[model samples]
Target: MREISLDRLRTLVAIADLGSFAEAARALNLAPPTVSLHIADLEARVGGALLSRSRGRITPTAVGETLVERARRLLVDAQQALDDVQRQVQGLAGRVRVGASTGVIAQLLPQALERLGQRHPGIDVQVAVLTSQETLLQLAAGTLDIGLIALPQLPVKGLDIHPWRRDPVMAFLPARWEPPAVVTPAWLADQPLILNDSSTRLSRLTAEWFASDGQQPTPRIQLNYNDAIKSLVAAGYGATLLPHEASTPLPDARISMHALAPPLWRQLGIVHRAGDSARATAHVLDVLWEQGVE
Candidate 1:
């Protein structure tokens, strides 16, 4: 079957609304002959007269009125489809996929997402909670739009990475512990230590710190969640090394933070596809840029 032309449908609607071919031609910036040809061709295709001549105006015949009604709805739908595509291309509305580690999601993303909603209610943020390494993997795979990761992560090409923040890695000890002036590896080695699990970058960093002093830490327990370690440390189970920002509000009031002798830190950075500057992503970056990243 031959599909109807959108141009012809539009012409039909204009002619019917204006009540004359000459008037529609003027409104559409087309010659009257072109307008009359449009109507004549439409009538021939339908195998019936489509308009009736009044004293000085025109009216649609029964079939023509039916065609005009359908034409109006069809034209509206076509225009709507165009607008939706444009919005997606412009990032004016759509879902932005974001990947972040547990620490960032817990402490930072809540406020960021809240501000994002207030400013651009049309853009939705989809969050995935992954470790820093995992977050970087997803970002490189193109499954993530933005990634918030703990550094120093191994660098990868095709990614735009920039430092977001850095916080001191401190010794978390029981609130009433001697409150040492500076926590040295010697003191940490002697204590039953609760450290992050070996799989994480923070764990590796802490291990390197201990290794620097010719000491190998024998952790009483290794766990991934900072809060859990903070809780154990607060109960006097052991001292722990954790980023100050990651274990905020101090999971337990009984836990106190002290700096390392030489001061260790966990750095955070943001990652995204190198060439991706999506509107929603850009807007989110704008809000974050003002956050004093680095």
Candidate 2:
């Protein structure tokens, strides 16, 4: 026996309500023969007559009555399911798992999320703090839906990546020191540099920037957190290089920001699985694009 067709079930309901094959056909936008065919198919499948025709009146058999009632409930459920998925596609609801660096999570994501919450409240964003390389790894492992990572990275296979923004690398020095308006890599190399530690892409980029000038500036101290590095810099521990957004110079004006000569920019970008179709993920990416790197 075959599964009962929804069309046939609907035709059964229409026929029973209209009390005539011709009338049901007209209501269903089908021919009288088509309506009769639907009833015949249904009766054969259920091994019973579904309608009794008497003097132009069509009364439904017990089987027809029971199935038509169930069909109405099923149709309602099916429509509800459709509506739910449609909302999901519109980016109104879903969950997005994100992985990003500390700098982005601290300075950028909070601002983006503020607007995101106002605009897409149904979309829940979950974040995990990770470095650029770790984010890429998680994206590949399918543990992350999207990633905010440093650009010019070694390409990860099967990932869709694009540059989002480039923030100028700035040097934060102690308040007492009056550095030049435009600091050069050579000049920065000579200072008691506080590097961002080798665990981060920033560390490699800064090191390469110094190396490009045929200079190897050794860091007086290495710290991972930007706040900690700034605290140390404020106390005259050493100067630090960071993306402009990462520098928090307020509350204690002990650090000053200076532009870099031949200004180096820390390129940041968003990455996701190729052909990602998650609506929440796309919505977040769109928000990031519209929001830019604030």
Candidate 3:
């Protein structure tokens, strides 16, 4: 009996899932003949045919089905073992992958990451700019170590969430449309509005706020990008509502921010995989919280 290689098992699994040698080969970026050779070698070692082939479709035989089941478990164990070894050797030297919403990253992460680099020079940090919803999904999928996101109304299962900061939502008014007194939602709504798209949590919240008040403010323009919305508002195209942190002081002097009287606030938080036992992730979280507090 010969030892089976991990690559051979992976190829087998890929072929089984894809159901064709050519498809599996394309998926694995290998030639079709190489995939056939791997399966053949595995069958020779097992002393039984593992696949039934007809007209280019491939289905696993009885033994092939059994081996495929075991192969999946073996592959998972192998990956866990590799992660363990890398965790031990690198300790905190490898990459710490993080995801954050654009608003959070713009307001928070850059300074935190800079300070973290000063402290732990060995650890590499990679950040993916993602929406709040996308950040949560990526964290759940183990693609990200940490995510900075808006606080959800309901707690997300299988994640540790830490409340970080609460920023008040403010109205961005064009210089020409400045009101003599405090801004009212109804008054603000009457002007041409540049609003965030429906896909964003912020947009949803804003929509609900208007609906609850029985007010329907037709947006003159709908935009998804924060910068674009801000630019349009500053150019006197329309007024917008956004978190105070998301609104930067414009050098053009056309954009002015006013605090809402009733005070709508967006809570920001740091989310991580629940019970994740990675030191690099912990360190990054610490740096994030420290920077947020300052």
Candidate number with greatest lDDT: 2
Local accuracy of candidate 2 as per-residue lDDT tens digits, 1-294 = 578777887888888788988888999899888988998998888889888878869998788788888878887787888887888888888888999977788878887887788989999899999988888999999999999988888877999899888788888899899787778888888889888989998998888888888888778888778878878988998898888764333425888888877778898888999999888888888888865654
lDDT of 1 at 218: 88
C-alpha RMSD in Å of predicted model 2 compared with the true structure: 5.7
Clashes (backbone N, CA, C under 3 Å), per candidate, total 0, 0, 0
lDDT of 3 by residue, 1-294 (tens): 579999899999998998988889999999888998999899999999999987778989999999999999999999998986686455545678888766667667777888888877767889888888888888788888888887774577898888877777878888777574766666776778899888777888777666666778989998877777888988889988888754334424788888775567777888888998777777788888876631
Per TM-score, the best of the predicted structures is 1
Candidate 1: lDDT of 275? 87
Ranking by TM-score: 1, 2, 3
Cα error of candidate 3 at position 157, Å: 3.2
lDDT of 1 by residue, 255-281 (tens): 887889878988888888898867888
Task: Give the total clashing residue pairs for model 2.
Answer: 0
Give every collision pair in model 1. Answer: none
Model 2 clash pairs are none
Lowest lDDT 10-residue stretch of candidate 1: 285-294
Error of 2 at 259 (Å): 1.1
The per-residue C-alpha lDDT of model 2 at residue 5 equals: 79
